[model samples]
Target: MSDHERKQLEDFLAAIEPNIAGYNYSTFSYLAQKKGNVFELAQGRLVLQGVPATSESKHFESPNLKVGFLHLHELKTSVKQFIESLLTGKLLTPHGELRFAPEKDRSHSIYFNPFHAEGVPFQNRQAFQYRQMQLHIRGDRRERLDSLSLDWELKAGPIPFEGVQELCAEFGVGQIDGDSSTVEIVAFSVAAIGGESSVTGTKAKLVINLVDGLEREKASIGYRLIERNAVVKRGILSGDALTWENATNFQRGVAELEVTGGAVLHCVASHGGRAQHHYWVADPATAQNPFRAIHQAFDKNLDVLQELVTKAQTKGANARDLEIAVAWLLWMLGFSTTHIGGTPKTSDAPDLIAATPFGHLVVVECTTGILKEDSKLSHLFQRAEKIRQTLISCGNQHLRVLPVIVTTKTRDEVKSELDQAHKNGALVATIEDFPQLINRTLLVPNAERLYTEAEENLKRLQNPSPFDVSGTKTNLLQ
Candidate 1:
């Protein structure tokens, strides 16, 4: 949680991502702290914690980034138990000094709370702190938490370094200068807030914390349980509700859960801009597989345009030069070069990345082919571009911002803009050109990856079975 960043902090995030998946902030809160430092966190408001639907409000891939407040009281005791086992090797309860653990389904981000509060198992130590936020989630274990990863966040507070040795040693956190005014602790957290819920009988558990701004006061938020149904309506299966009209194999049950328990988390922080894409896995077995035969006349078939950009536009551009710059650019996007375009295309991005002999990094974007309408990443383009710019300040940032790749309808749109930024010395590509089956270099969606992210998006939405994602929110619960 931060606004203006320092060179060190910026550089740190540039190289070491703190699990910034495809999420946007919907809330921000700062607890009053007298002597401790306060770090701001703008995490995902909507979490992918349920089995996804093959279709959403319109389709079945991505829904709008959702938001909901979380509170310690709302989350049942054993909610984050699976997560605690992964980290502190304990269980979640209403007693203890303080502990941090991961949600079972989601491991990328961890939960923070007082091991146990003051007077009782759940008493407020600080009486002054009073800022809070509210969040709502459709209660479902299968509808909760997915994936797992580890990263860092900035936190400034007086270290209760006496008895927290177990926590610090486990996470490899070292004690730094004790200056409360200006010291950044490499706080540890885990999570991979992605799609496709496999948890069938789960509920969200809230975490209670006593540090950070809690030194003087308490910051609290309420967790709301909303009844969200993971279903698809038969009407959506018909061609009338889809943006991609050609999808004929369209069926409510086609979409299967790919990645389950993507480790979704929520925080009271308002944030803006595009972050990164977590290679969050969905249990394909359980996820809703949404890809079907649809009549999408809009598919632009940007393959030809992508070929022109990489083969023709990069006439004098060194493959190494492009890889270094673009890798660094996309790294800020929270994804390695594993998932590039939505699906497979020509001019494979993985090959391009492999050819780059530079010790540059690999950046990947996981835009699905079924989402784009005008070929562009659509609404998410600006955030991706912003992330590209944010990471450029890093010394050895190697970045690549691939284009959006969803369906055939988006082909023409991508074909023309394949090299929009190439003229300005930026490396860009569309899904039509990336091939990365054998190598882990490019994050291009295959039949499996495509189904996973899409299925998760569909399940996380509040819909009925056989429902269609027509005119629905496209943001995934990042």
Candidate 2:
């Protein structure tokens, strides 16, 4: 490749990175303890986790720094907005713009944008021209700059502990105490199937780990008897270990049944204040495949799926895995799914294209980050509309294309600026409603209904529910 082409490729790759810089930035921990209703925060030192200890010396701490309680309300909304701006590459702030600096651990840290500093000469200041290029090597032929300017680099700063302290004082939010609060940090992992389950035509044995102290609740065991690519029978069954009162720790549940063919089991147990699901396939060949676990394990394990979805933007491999998982999710919901984002590089089309046999089409774009300035919603909308136009030209008048953006961010965050997204007939699936969608898919497994619900959700956002002024009864002639 020519030097210019190589540089162009590098710029394109950087632009698509979740964080142009600071991809390896480390996070610090602070002391915090729950005291009654509030958490008492204390000064905490930063430590290297994956990075080496030698890099710690490069971090300079401001003198006389102390920690304070985590005030219930300390301009949290503003802080969130600031963080969102940084994540979205908007580079809007009262202070200088931020830039990525190299750390000793071969990682990057955020600092004030050095190129735009006041003392730097205008001509000498380095500028990275973000020209349009093929995000993926092949897929789309023409390359043109997108409407939004996504040229801002990633940024970071020192532990904002003292900064938060100063802000609290300035805003009269609270006072900082030199005394640190006592806190304990624990790494909690979700319950899983620790022991191997025996699967036969007559019965299946399931062993699961339940939380130590949490109350054990009811278990929902449902199965589908598949024969010749058809579900001959489907029903719920019960077992002893399905309930913890009868057994302890890793309990084994024996599901008694008589079947002549392979069966698919869906076992959900309620424990640790959450529902844990495990899938078992009867065929040994199916179990032997490497991706069988990812296909089945990740289906019901929403927690791990959520983490992978959240990291999709940052990690290329995670993005591919997320696409596969999403496609599997759609398939589970009875939709003919296509994972189009499996290209070696980023693709031009949406991540997934799914359709119900009845001509109900959905184009989905998945992201765990903010969808504000440099969002893919617009791109998705355009693609969906283009598909609709093409289908119409092909004389498929009954077909409908619904654009949906699935994000791991909460509903409130995605709802902050919904007018534009709703304006383009796009529905957002936030983290809050994502689990509901998954559970509903598993329980119902109706693609037609899901598409209808997606359309209704978009319509509801467009119209919204009417507000009542008063509770007074109005007389007909009053």
The best candidate by lDDT is 2
Where does candidate 1 have its weakest 10-residue lDDT segment? Answer: 58-67
Instruction: Mark the regions of model 1 whose C-alpha exceeds 4 Å error after superposition.
Output: 1-202, 212-217, 221-478
In angstroms, the error of model 1 at 361 is: 22
RMSD of 2: 20.2
Total backbone collisions, model 2: 1
Residue range 330-422, candidate 1, lDDT tens digits: 332223343333235723333222112233332232232323333334334554555467658764346443323222212333445433333
| Candidate 2 C-alpha error for residue 50, in Å | 28
User: lDDT values of the candidates?
Assistant: 0.24, 0.43
The most accurate candidate by TM-score is 2
Clash count in backbone of candidate 1: 142
Model 2 TM-score is 0.43
Deviation from native of the Cα of residue 360 in model 2, angstroms: 3.2
TM-score for each model: 0.18, 0.43
Q: What's the CA error at residue 476 for candidate 1, in Å?
A: 12
